[model samples]
Target: MKTSLPIFVRNSMYALRGGFLVRPLLISLALGLAGMILSSAEERFPVVSAWVPDALFPSHADPQVAQVMLSTIASSIMTVVSIVFAILLMTLTLASMQFSPRILVNFVRDHVTQWTLGVFLGTFLYCMAAMPAARSLPQPFAPVATVTGALALALASVMGLIYFIHHISRAVSVNHIVDRIARETERVIDELMPRKRGAVARGEDMEFEPEETEFAVLNVRSGYICFIDTTRLLKLAKAHKLRIRVLRPIGHFAPEGAPLFTVSHKSRLTAELDRDFRSAFGIGPMRTMQQDVEFGVLQIVDIALKAISPAVNDPSTAINCIDQLTSILIRWAERAPPATIFSDPPYVVRVILPWPDFKHLLDTAFEQIRHYSANDVAVSLRLLRAMDDLAATLNDDSMRKEVTLCGRRVVANCATRLDPTNLKRLEDRLASLEARSPSFATRGA
Candidate 1:
C-alpha cells in the first residue's frame, strides 16, 4: 500500500530503530568521512599535526612508518570486526533457539551491539581512508592528526568491545530479556494509553454494523497492519462526510482482495478516496511493537512456555516472567483505553476504531502462561499473586471482577493438578483476590 508521507516516514523510522542496518551504516560512514576530511586537512596544513607526540610518531616527514602503522591497525580492526560479528550471530542463534525467535528484534535493536559493530568497522575504514595520505611519492607526508584520531578510535573500539561482550552476557539471560520486553511494552502502553487510572474510556465497544449501503475497500496488500494513520483516517472521513469502520484490527494480516475497511455511504467513495484510505495504512511482512502490545506479551509468553517445558523446566524463570507480566498488567490497568471514536467536532462520530480492552489484554498476557504453569507450585502461586496484584491496582469494579474471575480459573486449573495443601494456598490467595479494600466484587458479580 502507498502510505502518506507522515505514515511512510513513521514506518521508516520504526524500521530504522529496530533493524541493525541504518544506525551502524550511518555511524560507519560518518566516521569514514571524518577520516578522509581530517587526513586531507592535515596534509595541506602540517601545523595540524604539531601537537602529535614525538614518541608516538617520531617524524611527520616519514611516510613508511605511518603507512605501516595505519595498515596494521586497519588489518587488525577488520579481523576484530569479523570476530565480533561471529559472536553476535552466535548469541542471536542461541537466544532464538532457547527463548523465542521474536526476541531477535530486541537483540538487533540493542544499542551496544550496534555501536560495537559500527566502531570496529569505522576504525578500519578510518585507517584505510587515511592510509593514502601517508604516501612516499607525495613527498613524504604523514597525517599524524588523522592517525591519532584512528588510534583514539581503535582504543575506543577496544573499550566498546569489552562493554558489548558484557552487555550480550547479561542480555542473553532470561531475566534481562524479560525485563527489557516488559519495559518496552510499558513504554508502548504509556504512549498509546496516556490517561490516568479511573478515567473512563469514551466511545469504547463502539461497533459498526455492516449495512447494504456501505462500500468495502478491498486490501491490495497482504501483510500485517503495522501502522494506521488515524489522523489521516479521521480527516478523510470528516472531509467526505462518511463514517469509516476499519474492518481489520491493527497489527493483523489483511489478505489480498480482503476488505480492509468499509464506508457508510458508497456515493461518497471514489477511486481517489479509495487510494487515500489505503494510503493511511502501512503493511509489513511481520508484526511490530509500533502498535501491537500483544506482540510483546506473546514474546514473553513464548519464553515462559519454553521455561516451563519438560525439556527445560525452570520455575524461577517462569516466576520472573510472571512478575514482569504483572508489571505490564498494572501499567495497562492504570492507562485509559486508546481513543476509539474520532470526531471532527463534538458529539459526532466520524471514525469508529476499536482497541484491545483490559479483558482482551489480560487474556493475552496471562492465559497461556497461566495454563502452562498451573502444575508448578511456585509458578502457580506467582500467577495467583500476579492476578491479585493486577486487580488491586485498579478502581474499576468490572475490571477487578474480570481479574478475579481469571484468578478463579487459575485456581481451578491448579486444583486439577495440585495437592490439597498447595490448592489451599491458591484458595487463600483467591480469597484475598476476591475480597479487597472498600468491598471488592463478589464471585457472582
Candidate 2:
C-alpha cells in the first residue's frame, strides 16, 4: 500500500516507520501530556486522589514528600534509560562482529529495543511533567493523583528493564538473527505477491526486450531504486494512452543522466509529465527489504559465508543458515510472483516493469553459499537437502528444473573437494532429489 503513494512521501514514511523515532516519540508525548492533564484535573476536584493518604503513603498534608518522590523517580528513570541504550549498542556491535554487519539493519528495526527505550524515557517525562504541580506556594497542592500515577509508571519501568535484558540476550544469538531475517523476507513476499501458487500460474511473465521509443526519460537523481510506484506508473500510462518501460528494477542504481525509462509514444513531452514519471521511483543510498527480497537473502548469506570460512569454520552455523534459507525459498515457491507486464485493459500491456524471477531469487539465495560450502560435508549435505525441499514445493516445471540443476552443481562442486565417502553422501541425496522431478526422472528412465 505504501507503493501507492507518491515517491518522496512514501520514502519519508518508511524511514520514520522503520527506525526508533515514530513509536517512541508518539508514546513519550502522549504520556507527558497525560501527566499534565491528570495534575490539572486533580486541582479542580480533590476527591480523585483524596484516598492516597489513607491507602498508599499516609502523607496527605505534606507537599514536600510528593515533590521528593517525583524528583527521585524522574532522575532514577533517566539513569536506567542510559543503561538500556548502552545494552542495545553492545548487542548491535556483538551481532555485527560475530555474524554479519548487514544484520545491524534488523537490530535497528527491532521492536523490543525500540519499546524498551520508549517506556523508560516515557516514564521519566511523566514524572517531570507532574513535578511542578507539587509546589508549596500553589495552595500547598500535592497533586496526589499525579504522584500516584508516577509511582505506577516507575514500577512498570523496573519490570520492563528486566524483560529488556532477557530479550537482548536472545537477540544476539545467530539462530535468532537468521530466523528473524527469513521471516521478514517471507512477509515481504506476501505483500509483493498476493495470489497463492496453485491458484494462478504466474501470468504475463516476460523479460525485458530492447526497442527504440520516441522519448527516453533520463534519471535526474542517482541512487538505488528502493521502490517503484507501479500503481502510479500504470495510472499515468493508461491516462496518456502510451507504453512505459522501466529500464531498472528495484534494488538497481541509476546514475544521473541515465535512461531510466522509455516511452513508446510521446509526440510532445512536457516537463510536468517527465517529473511525474520520475517521481514514481523511490531512490535511496541503501537497499531495503521493502521491495527487495534478495536484500534479506544476502544478509543471511553473509552470515553463512563467514561461518564456513577458514577462520571461523562454523559448520553448525552454516547449516542453520541453509535451513533458514530453505524455509524462505519454500515461501517464495508457494506465492505468485509480481506481475512483470502491467496491463490496463484486458489484453493491452500499458506498463512494462521488471521483477526478479524465481531463478534469479533462487541463485541469489543459494549460489554463493553452495560454492563456498563445497568442501564442508555437513554444510554441503544440508544444502542438498535444502534443494530437495525447495524442489518438492515448487509447482512450476521450470522452477523445479532450476532447482534440479542447482542440486547437480552442488554435487559436482563437492566431488572435487570432498573425499570419496563424503562425495557419495551428496550424490545419494541428489539422486533422491532428481527422482521427484519429472524431467530428471524421465531422463534416467
Candidate 3:
C-alpha cells in the first residue's frame, strides 16, 4: 500500500508538470487548426470564381450578400490571429523580464525593423492568397462565389495595410527604447538590493535605535541627501552613467556630523492618545560581520607590533620588520570579500608601500632610532603625522572601518605605546628611551 501511494503521488506530480508545459502549445495549435479548416472551406468554395468578370456577378443576387459572408470569415480569422500573436509576444516579453531584462530591453529597443518586416510579409502573403482578378466587363450571369473571393481579397488588403501602418509607428517611438532602459534598470536594482535576515521589506517605514551599531544615518543638504561625499558619488555616477535619483540607499554612510534618525516616543497632534503609546520602529541593519572580523584582526596586529623594537635593533632587523609588516598589511587588505569593505565606516587602509619607498622609510627611521635611541621627539612626531595622513585619507566611515580592521590584524601595540616586547610596538616607545637617558649619561662621564 505504501509503495502504491508513493507511485500515485509521483504520477500526480508528473501530470501537473506536463499539464503546465503542454496547455498553451495545445491551445495555440487548436486555434491554428481551426483557422486552417476555415481557410480550406473558403478555398473549396472560392467565392468570386477564378477570372470571372465582375459584370457576370448578377445585380439581382446582391453583391452585398457575398461580401458579408467573405468579410465575416476574414474578420474571424484576423481576430484569432491577432489574439494568438498577442499572447505569444506577451509570453516572450514576460520570460525575458524575469530572466534577462537587459536582453529584453535591447530586443524592444531594436524591434522597429523586425516589426516592419513582419508587416510587409503579412501584406505580401495576403496579396498572393487574395488572387485579385482583372476583368474588362461585368456579365449578367456572374456567380456569387466570384463576388465572395473579390470581397475577401479586398478585406485582406485593408488588414495588411493597417498592419503595415501600425508597424511603421513603432519607428517613431523607436520601439520604446528609453522606456525599456528604465524598466531594465529598475529590474536589476530590485534583484540586487539586500535581502538578508533583518532586511526591511518594501513600503515599510525604517525605525532605528540610538545605539544600534549597524544603523545608518542620512543628512540632506542643498537639496541633496549627502550620504557619503557628493563628489565621490557624482564621480561614480558619471562613470557608470546611472540615472538613479537616490534619496537614500543601503550601504552608504551619512556625512560627518550627521544626525541619526530614530523613532520618536511622542508627537504633538490635535488628538490625545494613551500615555503608554509607543512609536513603531524598524530598519535593516548594515552587514558588518566582515568589518567586525577585520577589526579584531587589526587589534591583533597592534598588539604584535608593540612588542618589537628598533632602538637596539640592527639595521637589517628594522628592514625585516618593515618588510614583514608590509606583507601582512597587503595580505589583509586584499582579502576583503565582496563590497563589504566599502559598505560601512571605520575604513582601514591595508596595503604595503612599494619596494624602494618602504625600504627607504625603514632605513630613515632606523637611522633616527640608532642615533637618538627611540627618544627623539621629532621622529615620534613624524611617525604620528604619517599615521594621521593615512587616517585622513580614510576620510569617511567606510574607508576608516576597512583600514582600522586591517590595522588591528597586522599591527600590534603595547599599553606603554611602544612595541611592548620590541620598542616599536607601543605608543610610548620614546618614553622608554627617556627613562634610560640618565643612566647612560652617568656611565659615559
Candidate 4:
C-alpha cells in the first residue's frame, strides 16, 4: 500500500506539467535574478565594465542614457506582456466557446505558449533588474553590458511574440488540436507499453483463486483515480506477503469510504500499510495523462461530440476528430498493453489490477461519438472507415472481430437514421471492415 519513491517522483512531474504557471514563473524569476547579479557585477568591476564595446554604447560614462534605455525597455516590455496575455486569454476563450472546454488543458500545456509567456516576462524582469544598476549616484556607471543584454532579450522577445502569434493561430484550429491530442496519447502508449507490436508472449490466461480472508480498504478521498502506482502496489504486496486487488481503475471515480482495494491476509494489515495503500493511488478532481489513456481519448471525443451536437452541427470537424481517433487507435493497437497482473517473483502474483483492454479502449474512443453521430452520414462513414483502418492494423483475429462488430454497430445505427444512398455508403464501408476479417468474411459469404 505504501507508495514507492519512483511513483512519487512521477506524480510530482505530472503535476508540474499540468499547467502553464510553474515553469514560466521559474524561468522569469531565474532570468530576473541573473540580470540583477550580472548588472551588479558589471558595475562593481571596472574590468568587467571594460568588456562593453564602445560602438554599442558611445556614452558609457553618462548613466542617464542607460537608465532611460533600460527603463523604457522594461516599461514597454511589460506593456507587451499585458498585450500578449490579453491575446492569449481571448484565444482561449474563443477556443473554449467554439470547441470543447477540455481543450484548454492542451493549450495550457503547449510549450510554445509557455515559452512565450516566460520569454516575455523574463525580458521584462531582465530590464527591470538591470535598470537599477544604471543609476547616476556616487560615481556615474552605465552597466553598458547589462543594458546590451536587456536589448538582446527585448529583440528575442519580439521574435518570440511573432512565433507565439503564428503558433496560437494554428493551435486554435480543430485539426491541430486533435493532432496534438493524438500525438500525446500515442507517446503515453509507447511509454506504458514499450513492447513492439506482436512482441508480447501470448500465453494461456491464468485463473486467480479468491483469498479466504480478504478485507476491503476504504478510500479516504473522493475524486477521480488519475493514476495507480502499480509497481509500488506489487512491491508492497510482496513485502507484506499478501495479494492485492485494486477496486477502481485509472480514470474511475472513487467515492469517500468506498472500497479502494481488497487485500488478502487481512490480519497482517497495519496502520502504516493502510496509509501506503491510499498513497499509492493518486486521486484528484480531474484526470491526468499519467496512466489514464482514456482521458486523452475522451478529449478528442469531447470535441467530436460538441461538433456533431445539434447546436454546432459541424460534420467536418467531427470527421477530422474521427481521422485522428483512427490514428490513435492504430498506434494503440500496435503496442502491447501493460500487464494487468503484476507478480513479484517469477510467477507469484502479488497485485491484480484491471487495465482497459483494446476493446474497452475502442469503446471509449468511438462509442459515445458513434451514438451521437448516428444520424450524420458523413460522420458515420468516417467512423466506419476509422474502424476499418483499425481492423486492418490489428493482427489478432479477436481484435479484428471486435473492430468488425463496432463497424457493424455504426452501420446499424446509420441505417436506422440515414437515407438509402447514405446507408449504402455506410454498408460499403462496413463491407471493407468485414473483408479485413476472415471470420466476418466467412459469415458474410
Candidate 5:
C-alpha cells in the first residue's frame, strides 16, 4: 500500500510526546494541584484535631487519623502512577529497537522534562500536607518528629524519580542488545540458508526449464544486485548472431537447480559453460522475489522524494527521507497481512482501497518527510487526517467496496477521457527518463 509520510510523522510526534511524556505530566500535575488545594483547606479549617490528645497540644484538638491515612493513600496512588509511566517507557524503548531508535530518544527527552516537573510538584504537595501534621505532634520530640516525617516523604519522592530515570535509561540500552542480535541472526542465516542455485516453484514437485538464451547469475544485496558481468553472454550472443532473452525475469519464482539457459553456442566448450554456471548460479547469485519487492519500494521512495523536494529542492533532506521511507516500505512489505482465502488475487493492490484511504497513507508518509524539512504541524496534521481517512476506509467494508467500484469507474473513464497522443507523450518522457537513470526513473523495468 502507498504511504502518506505526513501521517506517519504526525502520529510519531503525538506518540512520542502525548503518550509517554505529556500525558503522564498532565495527570501528575492535576493530582498534585488537587492535593495542594486539599492540604491548604485542611490547614485552614483545623477539622481533624479531635483524634490527637488536647493536653499535649492545648490550643488545638487532636488531628484526625483519617487525614494521615488519606495522605498515605494519595502518596501511594502517585507512586502507582509513576510505575505505570515507567512501564510505558520500557515498552516504548523495546518497540523502538525493532523500528526506529530516534523515536525512543525523543520520547526520553520529552518525558524527562515533563515528568521531572511533575515529580517536583507532587513532592511539594506531599511535603506541605505532611509538614503541618508533623508540627502538631508533642513537644521535646517535635523538631525530631518533623525532620523524620519530612525526610520520609522526601525519600519516597526521590526513589520514584530515580526509578523513572533508571527505567528510561535501561530501556534505551536494550536497543543496542536488539541490534547485536539482529546482526548475528543475519550472519547465521546467510551461512545456513544460502541462496538456492535456481528459483523455486510454488508447488513441491513442479520442475521447469529455463527459457532464456543467454544467462548469468549473481548475488543480490540491499540497493543492488551483483551479477556475472554479462560480458561473456554478450560475446556469445553477438558472435553466434543469437537472440538474448531473460528466462525468469527479476521477480518471478523458479524451481531450484533449474537450467537458466540452453546455450546454442557452436563449437562451445562444455567445461567452460559448466564452470561459469556452477560458479555463478551455484552460489545463488541471482536476485530473488524478496529483493525485487525491496527494489520496487525503494523506487517509490525515490519518486516520493521528487514529489516533495523543496522548491520542491533540498535533495539532501529528500534523499535522507527517501532512505527512511524505503526502510519503512521494506519492513511493511515483509509483514504484509496474509491474503484472505476468498481473495480473487493475492496482489496487495487488489486488497487495498483506492482514493482517500490511499491518500491518507500517502499523507502520513509525507509528514515524515516534512518533519525533517521544517516540522510544520498543520501540514503534518493534514497528512495525518488523510491517513485516518484511508485507515478508516480500509477498516470499513462498505467504504472499501465503494472504493473498489470507484477505481473500476476511473479506469473506464480513463479509457474514454485519456487522449492516446497525450498517453504516448507521457510514456515517451518516462522512457527517456528511464534511459538516463534506470535505477530511479521507472516504477518497474
Candidate 6:
C-alpha cells in the first residue's frame, strides 16, 4: 500500500485540478464557515450596533428585521443557484450536441464556470449560516453586521449571475473552444518537454540490455495509462539495483494481467516491489492532458471531424481547428520531448520508457482529418496550409519531410474523391509545401 501512495496522491491531484466539484465545494464551505464565525462573534460582542451608524440600519436592534432579511437573501440566492445550474446544464448539453462531446472536459475545467457556481452557492450558504443567529431569543439579539454582510453577498450574487450568463454565451463558441484546447496543448508541451531544442538529440533512442531472467509486471486492471511517475520509477530502480522498462506508453490501454513493465531481475522482485511498480502509473478510464499530448490533439481533431462530417459540413470550423492544431504543432516542434531513459548517475540507466515522437504526434493530429475531409476542397486546402506552416516552423529535416509527406497523403487521398478542379487546388497546396522543404525544392522547381 505504501507503494500505491504516490499514484493515489498524483491521481487525486489530477482529479482535483480538472474537476469542478472540489473548488466550488471548498469555496462554499469556507464562506459558510466564515459567515457562522462572524455572526457568532457579532452576537457575542455587538460590534455592529456599537460602531455602525443608525442610518445604515435603523432596525439594527430589531431581531425580526434581521431574520426577515437573512431569510429573503438565503431563499433568493438559492433561486439563483437553481437558475445557474439550469443554465449550466443546458449549455453543456448544447455544446455536446453542437460540438464534440469530448469538449465537455474543457467546459468543466473553465474556472469562470466553477467560480460562478461557487459564488452563487457560497452566497446561499453564507446567508443560511447567519440565519439562525438572527433569531429573537431571550433578548431580541440581532447581529447587524452579519445581516449587512448577507445583503452585500446577495448583491454580489446578482452581479455574478449576470457575468455568468455572459461567460457562458461566449464559452460555447467553436473558435473559443479550439483556441482553449490549443493553449492547453501548448502548456502541456512546455511542461513535458521543457528542454531547449538540441539539449537532447532529436532521435536518440535509449539503449539497455535486459537479462534473460527478466520478469513481467502485469497490470491489475484494465484502463488507460494516463500518467507515469518517472522519478519514482527511477528511484525504485536505483534502490533495487535493477533496470525497469515500461511496456506501455501513456494514453495506451493496459489490459488486466497484461505486462505493464518488465524488470531486469525477476529474483529480486517481491510483492511489495510489484505494488510499487504498479503504483508508479496512474490509470484511468480515459486519457487526460496531464501527460497525454495526443489527448489534446485528438480533442481538436474531434471538433474538426465533426465540422467536416456529412451531417455538419462546416468547413470553416474545420479550417479553424487546423489553424489551432498548427500552432500546437509549432510549439511541439520547437521543444525536445521528455527523455525516454532516466538515469540515477551519469551513464547508468535506471528506467527505460517509450514516448510518442513527432511523427506519431503529427499523424495523431491530422491523419483522421485527412481521411474525413478528402473531398472537401476548403478543408483539404487548409490542411495543406497547416502542414506547410508546420514545415516552416520545424528545423529538423526529417520532421519537415514528415509534414511534406502528410501533405502528399492529403493530396493523394483527395485525388480519388475530388474532381480535377478541386484536385488542382490540393496539388497546388502540396507543391507549395514541397517548395518549402529542402529535399523537395528541386521537385517544385
Find the candidate with the highest TM-score and give its number. Answer: 6
TM-score of each: 0.95, 0.93, 0.21, 0.94, 0.27, 0.95
Q: Lowest summed lDDT over 10 consecutive residues: which window, candidate 4?
A: 201-210
Model 5 misplacement above 4 A: 1-110, 136-317, 338-445
Ranking by TM-score: 6, 1, 4, 2, 5, 3
Pitting candidate 1 against candidate 5, the one with the higher TM-score is 1
Give the per-residue lDDT of model 3 (tens digit) for 1-445: 4323433354344333333233434433443343334334444665524444657544424434444444455465456556645654675475443323323324433433343333333333332233222122372222344344445544654565466456534522312332343333333223332243224322112222232132222333212111122233333323332211232332234443454231122132112121111010011222111112222222222222332334233333233333333333332222322221111212221111111121232233223332332443333333333333333433234433433332222223222344435444433433322223332223122
- Model 6: lowest-lDDT 10 consecutive positions: 201-210
Shift of residue 307 alpha carbon in model 4, Å: 1.4
Provide the overall lDDT of each model, using Cα atoms, as 2-decimal numbers. Answer: 0.85, 0.84, 0.33, 0.84, 0.39, 0.85
What would the per-residue lDDT of candidate 2 be over residues 155-236, giving only the tens digit for each residue?
9888888898898889888999999999998899889987887665444744433444658888987898999888888888
Tens digit of per-residue lDDT, candidate 5, span 108-181: 44545356546655555544454454344562112222223334545665786687667556645433323333
Which candidate number would show the highest lDDT if scored against the true structure?
A: 6
Model 6 lDDT at residue 190: 92
Q: Name the lDDT value of residue 371 in candidate 4.
A: 92
Model 4 C-alpha lDDT versus the unseen true structure? 0.84
Candidate 6 residue-wise lDDT, 50-164, digit = tens: 7766787788778899888888888888887887788788878988887888899888888988887888788888888988888776777888888778878888888888898
> What value does the lDDT take at residue 342 in candidate 6?
55
RMSD of 6: 1.8
Name the regions of candidate 1 deviating beyond 4 angstroms.
1-3, 197-201, 205-212, 437-445
Cα error, residue 268 of model 1, in Å, equals: 1.1
Overall local distance difference test of candidate 3: 0.33
RMSD of each: 2.2, 2.7, 24.4, 2.1, 21.8, 1.8
